[model samples]
Target: MWRTPLEQTATAALFLGIIMSQIVGEGSAVKVLSQPGQQVTLLCSYNYEDNTHIPQLSVQWRGPNNQLLCHYIKHKAYQNCTRGYTISYSPSSITLTIQHVHMEDFGAHVCSVSKPHEFSDYSMELARMSEYVTSAPKSGGDQSGSTWTLIIFHTLLSVCM
Candidate 1:
């Protein structure tokens, strides 16, 4: 399932999760299984019934622990982008592009927007990934994934012997 080069993300045990958020009112609450050094764009998009109409909008992208990456305000040139991060805007959406992704960059990314008579916010949370794509198994409802993997492996080994 990995499309990028191995050198870019060399951790077989390191799972990175790219939490997808579309109009996420709060944030994308999910685990991580994404590779480092890969670029990811968190988008804040709006869809109007009529494509011809555009609203005055302002946007801010915050990193983990309320770190401000950039902001695009209405009718303003107030620009602030930091290292390894970029922000761009269009009529319909604002995007936060993160480059050279590392462990430090892994966390909740929130996008706040203001418009005519309306205010909203969206978020994207990142974390470690897991081989079990669905959900991690629970041991008495409280066991780690690695422990479960070892248990299953031992069970299989005993059966083969």
Candidate 2:
């Protein structure tokens, strides 16, 4: 099987602090289910102690292969994204939107934000419904029932968060 790049770069720091942990109050190790050609957005949000003015904060969204999709420094947006991807950021959060998701896109996507010595980042995995179902082995019975069960489980996980 092909593997995503594990290069250590500024974006690499994203996996260090948390080692895959989400923001204080959010879901954990979530596998978002979707279909081919569907539009999807991965969001990374952070709450500040106060509405303090930010100075020189930078954010980057990387693909599964550790490819830098887009980078935003201060209020300026960089156009490194050319694979039908778009990125936008606000005071408290940054979002990466995929125009048309493909099978190759079904993997870990990361978002990193930084300023001076402090930084925060997180990653989310996207999987296709058909692929997910086939990879998940059910105890017994039809795949439809197993699929529904997995869907409900994911729903509950989202709700519990």
Candidate 3:
């Protein structure tokens, strides 16, 4: 059986559309800190074919020791936060506030957004601890104690997940 040229062209166009849709479907990137402790907002944006339902957005702050300090899930009024950290969000952004800034707060933080069937994620890092604070005190000791709390919290997240 011989197929018409128009049919072949339509089939080729459909295949190309499907491939392009998958490539540009959903993705996100965490913005670098324009400045530390200045109410930094991490943005997680995604593209979907349909927008009939409200999407779920999750944001987390990780400490220097790869620990989860704060987390927020959409629709939940309460947050899971570490002792010195707070979590909040808007429609398209999640913000983590670190009070009385300390060295342990320096590390990679991740922001993730998800819908019923699709999701996106991103990561950012604070290169130096001193960047968060202008003046440095002349004191040195094991800072691990302060960060230990975050580590424990991260463990709980792992178990729950």
Candidate 4:
């Protein structure tokens, strides 16, 4: 059978489209949070065309030197969290909670999901706050609480201006 120019072009385009879809992988934005003592949770969500089969999720927390501090795999019940780190995962998202925030914990955390042949990964930095302020002083040690109250009042007044 002889194929016309238009027919040949259309067939090539369709074939390319199918190949592109399989080659391209899906990825989601990485989000980071910080807390005082509790572990900080990093959330990542992704979507793909093929969702019939469940995907395997993996999360890794790396130090500034690119050392793997923690890693979690879906099927493996065991996790290799750092001395002070913990990792967990759900079907579509992965979470890494650092037991106690350390200087080395302030680095990139990577989250990845994979199927039989496709996978995607993303990374984000976790930062630590140098100084933290307390709500109030216990037992009314001094006029600090009153000073804070005045500060809040002025802040709110300025915002309303």
Q: Which candidate wins on TM-score?
A: 2
Which order, best to worst by lDDT? 2, 1, 4, 3
TM-score of each: 0.59, 0.63, 0.46, 0.51
Q: Which residue pairs does candidate 2 place in steric collision?
A: none
What residue pairs are clashing in model 3?
none
Please report the TM-score between candidate 3 and the true structure.
0.46
lDDT of each: 0.60, 0.61, 0.47, 0.51
Model 1: per-residue lDDT, tens digit, 112-141?
877777677776665443333343565457
Candidate 3 off by > 4 Å: 1-55, 129-161
Q: Give the C-alpha lDDT of model 4.
A: 0.51
After TM-score superposition, what is the CA distance of residue 153 in candidate 2 from its true location, in Å?
A: 5.8
Return the TM-score for candidate 1, rounded to 2 decimals.
Answer: 0.59
lDDT (C-alpha) at residue 127 in model 3: 32
Report the backbone clash tally of model 2: 0
Cα lDDT tens digits for candidate 3, 1-161: 21743333323332332333344443322223223333233333333324444545555656657688777766565479888677766554556656544555555666555556656665555433222222222478554643553354334334433
Using TM-score as the measure, what is the rank order of every candidate, best first? 2, 1, 4, 3
On lDDT, the stronger of 1 and 2 is 2
Model 4 CA lDDT for position 46:
47
